[model samples]
Target: MKIAVMGAGALGGYFGGRLAAAGQEVTLIARGAHLAAIRERGLKILSPRGNLHVPAIPATDDPATVGPVDVIMFMVKNYDVESGARAIAPMLGPETMVVTCQNGVSAHERLGAIIGAGRVVPGVARIPADVPEPGVINHSAMWDTLVFGEADGQVTARVEGFRDAIVAAGATAVLPGNILHDLWRKFVSQATLASMTALTRLDLGPLRTNPDSRALFTAAMEETERVGRVAVPDLPGELVRKEWEILETLPDTMHASMLDDLNAGKRLEVDYLSGDVVRLGRKHGVPTPIHEVFLAALRPFKDGDPAGLAKDAVQEFRTRT
Candidate 1:
């Protein structure tokens, strides 16, 4: 299958490179030094499963050049959903599947509004990957899976075909009966970790262990669940509890990707994760005080801290005191 990865950062690059290595025609859409490095030396995946180097996969910044493909992996950040959706228009064939692979549940809808709902496939990616440097993906965990399906809950041929391609590329691909519920289930845990970890500036190990932080974490999950139940009406009442149970099993070193972005002074997806919960809560008459606090506190850093002004102000205040 001809595949185009719209945001070929860690997540997109890892999967795209693997598919390319497996003999699928995959093109990476990226920019800056990362794109340059991929053009010069191809993409590299430093994974625990095994190291891989796809020496010559097509990499470019323009989708018009790649043209239409069998599938488009929409892996851009949550903030870039609309712009990215518009950008991928040149690559959408009549039956091309545009898989939404960002955090947050609303990406598919936003993309659908721009690119037609019929072609949008809701996806939930479970992987620990990051671009430590140009063209290099640092995979920190062993859990690597991609769960996706039609929004209508039908197991269509296209969905199965994509799953087969992913498995052939050496990664797990799950086709859940209810992708919406699966997406919300992931959001419950993801938003909780993203807020708690970034706000505390700690990893999951320390955050989940502290009694106060643990309580806050549980409450945040509850807030997200309340909103989620309304979003996906069939969402199970025990979902939050089950999600927390799974959280306990994750590696202590694990943390939300937002924390990584926070430490680097890069953009955070708080607007999509916690902020999405706040919006949904308001619409559903659910009180989400915890998520509201997270949204307010992280709003300033949503774009990024390129000049370190926030940090500088805190330092100056400390010195004056």
Candidate 2:
């Protein structure tokens, strides 16, 4: 299979590297220092399952250079979806499938509007991975899975073919009966973890072990589930429980990608995660107090802490104590 990873960051790099190592034709769409590192050396995967290095993998900033592929893993950050969609036009053939692996549920609609809905496949990436440095992907947990399907839940040949390819690459993939429910379920899980970890600057260890913090995390999950149900009414009533079960299985060091961005002083995905929950809650007349607080607290840091106000406040409080 010919595959192109549009973002080719942590998530994309890890999976795309796996596919490439397994003899699939994979091209990385990346830029900046990361692209430079890939071109200079190769893409490296630091994973518990196994370490992989795909030397001489085709990588470029321009999609036109790679031409069309069987599948395009659209893994850009939530904020860059529109521009990313516009940029991938040159790589879209008649039968190419664009799989969106973003954190929120809105990418399907946004990408559909730009590139035609028929070609879009909504997907949820369940993995704890990040790029601690250029050309390096740190898979924080042993769990790595991709759940995706057609918008209407049909078991098309292309979907199954991609699933087989992913399994062949040693990663799990699922074709859910209803992709919308899976998308919302992932949203509930991601939004809660992202907001809490970024707000507290802690990992799953402290958040899950501390009773008060764990309760607060549960409350945030409930808030997100409420809003999610409003969007997808047929969502399971035990969605919160399901998410909690998944959380318990994660390693102690697991944290959201948003927390990584926050620590790196890069732009955060606040508008898409917690901010989206608040916006949808208002539109559907649902109360989302927890997410509202998260939205307000993190909004200032959305574009990053350029003024260093957050750092100054922390230092001042430490000195006072």
Candidate 3:
């Protein structure tokens, strides 16, 4: 299958490199040092499952250069959904499937608005992976799964083919009957984890081990689930507990991508993750104090502190006092 991986960061590089190694025609869209590194040394995937180094792979920054493709693996940060969707117009063939493996729920709708619902496939990526540096993808977790399906819940030939392609590349793939529920299930845990870890500046071990922090985590998850149930009416009441159980099974060192962004002083996806929960809660008349606090506290750092302007401001204020 011909695939175009839009945004060749951790998720895109790892999965796209695998597909390319499997002999599928893949073009990775990336920019700056990452793109330069891939073009020079190829994309590298480091994982416990196996390490893969595709010494030579097609990569470019412009989607139009790739032309049309059978599928587009959209893995940009949540905030880049609309711009990413619009940027990939040249890659959208009539039957091209654009699947988003992102952190939030609204990406599919946002992509569908630009590229049409038929071309947008709702997907969830279950992998703890990141680009520790340009051209190198670090898959820290043993689990690598991609779940997706049509918006209307039909098991179409296109989705099945894409699933098979992903599985053939040695990654787990599923075409669930209801992708929205799966998305919300992921969001429940993701929002809580991202907000808690980013705000506290701690990993999952300390966050889950401490009694006070654990209670805060549970409360945040419950509030997100409450808002989710209203947004997705069929979402089960037991989803909160189910998410908590899943969280327990993860490695203690695991942390959300938002925390990674925060630590690296990069822009965060909080507006789309925790901030989404707050927005939906307001729409449905659900109270989300936990999420509200998370958003408010993290808002200043959403776009990062490149020059330490925030730090400088704090220092100046301290001197004034």
Per-model TM-score, in order, reads 0.95, 0.94, 0.95
Q: Which digits, one per residue and each the tens of the lDDT, describe model 2 over residues 237-288?
A: 7888998998998878888888877766789999999999999999999999
Mark the 10 consecutive residues where model 2 has the least summed lDDT: 309-318
lDDT of 3 by residue, 1-321 (tens): 999999989988988999999999999999999999999999999999899999999999999899999999998888898899899999988889898878878889988888898888899999888888899999987899899999889999999998888889998899998999999999998998998888876789899899999999999998999999899999866887898888899888888988767766789899999899999999999999989999999998998965776556545866998
Q: Which tens-of-lDDT digit does each residue in 1-321 have in candidate 1?
A: 999999999999989988999999999999999999999999999998789999888999999999989999999999999999989999999999998888989999999999999999999998988898999998877778999999999999999999999999888899998999889998998998998888876789988899988888888898898888887889867877899888888888888888777766789899899999999999989999999999999988999975897566555866998
Q: After superposing candidate 2, which stretches have Cα over 4 Å from the reference?
A: 311-321
Q: Runs in model 1 with CA error above 4 Å?
A: 310-321
Clashes of 3: 0
Q: Which pairs clash (backbone N, Cα, C closer than 3 Å) in model 2?
A: none
lDDT scores in order? 0.90, 0.90, 0.89
State each model's C-alpha RMSD to the native.
Answer: 2.5, 2.0, 3.3
Deviation of model 2 at 186, angstroms = 1.9
Worst 10 residues of 1 by lDDT: 309-318
